[model samples]
Target: MPRPAEAALLSTSLIPTDNSTYEALPLVDSESLQALITHEALNASALELFAIANASVKEYGHPTRVIGSGGHYKTLGWIEKQLKNMSDYYTYEKQEFKALNGMVFNHSLSVNGVKVLDEKPFQLTPAAHVYWADLVVIDNLGCEDIDYAPLNASLSTNTVALIKRGECPFGNKSSLAGKWGASAALIYDPESDEIITGTLGTPTNTTVGTLGISKTLAESLIAQKNAGVPLKINMFIAAYVGFIKTKNIIATTIHGDQDNIVALGAHSDSVEAGPGINDDGSGTISLLNVAAQLTNFKINNAVRFAWWAAEEEGLLGSNFYAYNLTALENSKIRLFMDYDMMASPNFEYQVYNGSNELNPPGSEELKQLYIDYYESKGLPWVLIPFDGRSDYVGFIETGIPAGGIAAGAEGKNSQNGEVLDKCYHALCDDVTNLNWDAFLTNTQLIAHSVATYANSLEGFPLREPPKVASSADVPYKFNLHGNFYIM
Candidate 1:
């Protein structure tokens, strides 16, 4: 990695004073970044959950609740408590922490529908009359101690598997379950509003299931079993099956009355391991702060904010959200700004220019946005090829303009003027490992571009999509699945 002092000096020295286009744009403040980091560090529920599981806080003499015992609980209440603590610590007034009833299935096990195979231990078999097998009730299972071997074996034929939702990695378990054969997986928590979906890894040869249930559902099923009552479940897996219910949380602020919209987004869900602070919490929090700060600011176009879920699972969330939009909605979307990993401590930042040769839909304008920000702030940035690794993939493939920023990640070598942040997705990605100044600067740049695009009288100046070259004209053709275009 570049020396901090050198990076700072180089960044400051590169300011472009001659540029009159964006001279008056506001820069991100270090204090804001510090405040965000502090808040994220203290309040991020994901991080706190991991800390409790790993017993990290136990060493500090304040042990967190366990997964299943009397004092052990995982509820939205606990999450709210943590959020409140952080808000109080940071003095954030009017802070509202809400855990929405995100999604529901058509078949969630209920006491009146399932036939108990073994009444003593409570084993169940579905009734023939039930059309939709939405819920699966398992006899004895804990998210932590459940034997996946049986579940894996059963997945080959089972559309859904009922499992407890504590102590296990939902993403990995869900992937394994999917690999075996299940169409969807449900993990109910004995305690909280932590309704987690299973993380799907890379696309598989066979498309089986699409969604995962929360721990709360599992607890409900267990209660039904204990009561010796059959459970009835109504399951509505989103039409985009094998990947159902994945969603992108989108919010928009119109600059003026412009029809064109500049979309800025980041995937909100993290890998099941940690709260994904650096992997995405950094980006999510940054975007939130920027949006909050820019809420009243004047803009000419529309600035949209989206927090995507299930991105860690093969970009399913964003893909579903983007593809499901109506034709009118698609036409209104002018540009896509994606921020995936934006605060890695190991590497210098990079801006992805849609493609190397021709600019992608909104590549040029996005590039100019970053360039203006860096030049005005005297920061050094490099433009690279779009790898289609994040939520922007759907937009770019649909020919919508797309560009994004990235911090470092694991396996990204510190080569070609890039430095690697080794702690990319590990638990070590705490605030201490981050360069707050860089984070703040990058956040400001993102916010500024969003604001600029919104305020510009001309809608996002989109370049035509690159022409599809014939196979003969193509130098090399890799057997890739999606469309690859130049920016």
Candidate 2:
């Protein structure tokens, strides 16, 4: 018996482009270090530093080399050797702060060492007496039992508060805390065990100081407060404020005679944690592969691929590029596709149809396109509610057609009766943990969909006049089943 074609998939070569200038844009060379940054080992500052240093050295007349070879691409010593190899072109330097800054410390203390200001289960001493802190520490303050009106009043004079972890949600707590007059808030762990960190939603209203600390440190601070000991702790934090310049690397290929454009994008910036391979490296690589495969195909409408920067800092890069477009350019845009996290082993695939309230112009057609492509390939998929969680937010906000696929993220996965990919936004999200089979399949689907849309003669496959629907007219009703929802 012979092996099936899908079982023995062969890599295809990208079609050569006549436009040499656009071809010059780097397109996922295996040697590129962008993939390595997905490991969560490198923080955003380090990634930025690496990009700046690499660009500077390249311009300084050093041998044109791929920057991804350092770190995981090679052995530690080999990585050092590569850096040394480029030493002639650039100098590596680290700056130290005069004050304890850019550093976070975790500490724990015995229960005997701490004092209880209040016998009540949750109440703690006021922030004024705690540490003369720019902010006060109030751990585990949630909305359920605890009333925040008093705390909010107390915080107005102090301007800062640190809440211990657990109980209520962070966003709700942050919202309540903001009402109480806090400039910033830190949520530390109660167990005093491992470091606790997670996403703090968009800081739209108030500038609330947010930080994660270990349970050990929280307990230690509590103990000190109880003992009436004047506790002195040190922490170093660094943030750069003001306008920073970044670029949106755009690579496009036009096939057919259509005037409309279909855009696919993935942000390249990693958070201040590790290389963001799963965070977005997976999406970036998938799109890059799609681009490489499309190079050979001639299509009608333009297919534009982009690797955006500064996405970690509030979608700055993508927003800037999308909004900065001229009237002519905006009109030419047909649909925007975003691939943020398209590969998580534990969760099923989903398509984000921008806002259920309104079809949002081109979303319904794009959703059908994804569904049809998945069906053609005999794959199972689900449609998820529209979320402005990625670069797609910009396009949707501007009334441009937008849709994309997400494998699984940090949320729970009801279909498989499993937790959502736990490694999301963590240092554990490396390639070793990915389900490559799913990755490959999803990547292929993305490429096929883009190619079909670009080749179709009906410039934009989506309906031009937006469809209006009332709650009674809506065809699908979602039923919540355990952790998963059935549509």
Candidate 3:
């Protein structure tokens, strides 16, 4: 069982943020490392993870673990307690940062005085209160600046800009609307009736507020504009945009080669929907289970396990950590492995591409490790682009070679042709959203992969001197928002 929050304070009791504390455990022979991970142990860990998650919902009176919320703080406590109780082999630190978070108190939209579905506000956007406004439709996929060139949007400051969700960040579309002098940007899913949710990457990315709507409503507005009818909307959104204090819990083994670190991370916060069980409860627990089991043996390279916050808002926690690292500090980490959504209900073994263009170098080798592991077990695995969908965005843009695994969320299940996790970012993504068989399998992979590198980085290339790249250089795959999707 997870301990109470008060006891979790011990996780804050050790290690300096600058990588100081070091205690060495005798390194075990590389050949005997396989015995470190056991199925019984993994099953036990899974139960603990689910219990902690479900219990938080009951204790906090809300399912979401969004930043600064009770549920989010509770998960941080659980993570701390889990690591601090692990035989004193770990020394932990709380890396603090200022997280920019936005909240929508209430939002609703109406067209021609007819009620419609409430528009969900994207994170980090300003509030909106428009009594009335004419509608302007962005005709093409507003990905690039040129796409918005032909748009005949209104010049009035009171006009509403409507655009379709297409090959770009919703922020880019909204930002374009801000350029054309619109009061608000309304993005709609031209392909699906289901409404969407997202973040604008950072605070004040646009002057006007951004909200999402559905195809049925959007098409009606477009048709009205195409015809000779006037379209006006009354939209109201009460929101707050500001910074919040949050911390990342990074626990390092007290014993091992501190120079060549094997860092593994998963974001600790969730979307404003559901308990986030499969989206990241699985990812969080995978690290916990592996961290605990690995203590049975010794490691050659030090292992670091991190719980990142504000990943839903953008990769805030990990980005802060990566950005603040000195060049020398960046070189110590030989590999970075991110675990996210390890147990999607409709599961597939998806490994991020080692050859992913976003990866710095030595990433392809990391990709092959998972591929080889899966092939050896006769498990079918597919390739996914190492997009900026998760916390790895921080490590890679910092020029650290990184790779990891995911069970997938929005992608279609090859067999049935359905969304991988139908409850993705929805209120239904609870403990029951997990596929146990797949969970166990991936948990084993997490343990095996971590232990393999910890024992020795035999072929895992040493990280090159980081030639840091700008954030724009990284191809962050949009369709992004929350945890499983892009940003």
Candidate 4:
């Protein structure tokens, strides 16, 4: 989508794949407001930005974007300097990662006479108490009214509880079941379809060493009970606390009405296992591209651009910012739009379902804005549940209306197809692993959304005080080696 420069004005000395070519690429003039908001202009910017990231990876390594690392800090600093060159409205904030040191669990269960306990180091419930116990399946889904009576009437002493996932907070389910005499708890998808992993809300938070299970396993155990077969399972968990320091980069327009702000964000850090180019490089670069173009135009309502850190580590960076805001500061934020992954190799256009599921007041309007854009373009899109899988987690938690788009992540390309973004969270998610078409398409949408709200917050509702909720209520399903569970 990049426009070719006039050959006479361009030098033939630089190689297109070289970093020098990226440095030599033309950027929109700071006063060119007309060029700034145009979709083609932003897409062109994104192409060059991607070149910069590819260069960063080449200079560093596959795991180059880990938070607080020298490579990550230096790269982020370079970006900050670029923003400063365009405008003087940027700052950085540092936060401790508050390390969740270690979690080890020994689980044992029998399915159809097959003993399936491999002694894996399962993720622990935050601050969960150390314990070992036999397990029992609760009669009611583990969402509400979890009393010991049903658990007691179903199983004997020291029996762990297996409850379906829904309704109440994850920690709440374990806490309530523990109150009723269960030594530990296991929460699984009600449909028994996926593997789920999540935080227990906070580092110091405690619960009954709860474990998330696959819907398949839970259903099997339930069927065994129904067939008058005995179901005995054992689970043990141990955990400790620790911290890592990270930083967040925030930029705001100095010329707009600062009282009513529109914020957009994307996580900049990658996962521990990979470079996370598609997982987040896509989102990070898209916003950076938008931010660079926006410097060309003045706005009515102030717009803030945030490059969050440690989002893959359970939305830590955004959580710190939102949680630390004063009521007045929070209210100034009309809405928060999050962009995580935008160019999965096996791509699908996904718009966050802000209106119905995570209805943070004005979220529906934001959702419709995206829907209308895709519809107008004659491109099909699916509404994805606004689960707290990325930085938007913190924004929605703060009751700040939020919405955004994603190409695809580790999910399937279709019901019968392979995993979307085959290299997701893998080392292969490098410079060559993106869908350029999807990337440009989504980048244009980012420009549209940011420009729309920046010019006017008309239909975008104002914010009220936020009541943050635990993210465990919305389960993320994962299929590991064909074993599906919530993550």
Which prediction has the highest TM-score against the true structure?
3
Q: Please give, for residues 126-180, the per-residue lDDT of candidate 3 as tens digits.
A: 8888877877777687666666543443455578878888676766777777776
> What are the TM-scores, per candidate, against the unseen true structure?
0.51, 0.60, 0.86, 0.64
What is the lDDT of every predicted structure here? Answer: 0.48, 0.49, 0.74, 0.62
Give the root-mean-square deviation of each candidate in angstroms. Answer: 16.5, 13.8, 5.9, 11.0
Best by lDDT: 3
Candidate 4 ranges with C-alpha deviation above 4 Å: 1-133, 145-150, 154-156, 203-206, 226-238, 242-247, 254-260, 268-281, 293-301, 309-320, 326-334, 344-348, 352-365, 384-401, 407-436, 455-487
lDDT-superior candidate, 3 or 4: 3
Put the candidates in TM-score order, highest first. Answer: 3, 4, 2, 1
Reference-based TM-score, model 3: 0.86
Candidate 1 lDDT over 448-487, as tens digits, reads 6665666662655654433222324421122222211110
Off by over 4 Å in 1: 1-246, 356-359, 411-419, 457-487
Tens digits of per-residue lDDT, candidate 2, 89-205, equal 212221111110011122121123343221111101111122233334553454432555445445236444557655544545555666666654555656434455543323335
Tens-digit per-residue lDDT, 272-377, candidate 4: 3356677688787778777877755556778888887766556667766776666677788998998888878888889878773436788889889889988988
The better-scoring model by lDDT among 1 and 3 is: 3
Single out the weakest 10-residue window by summed lDDT for candidate 1: 118-127
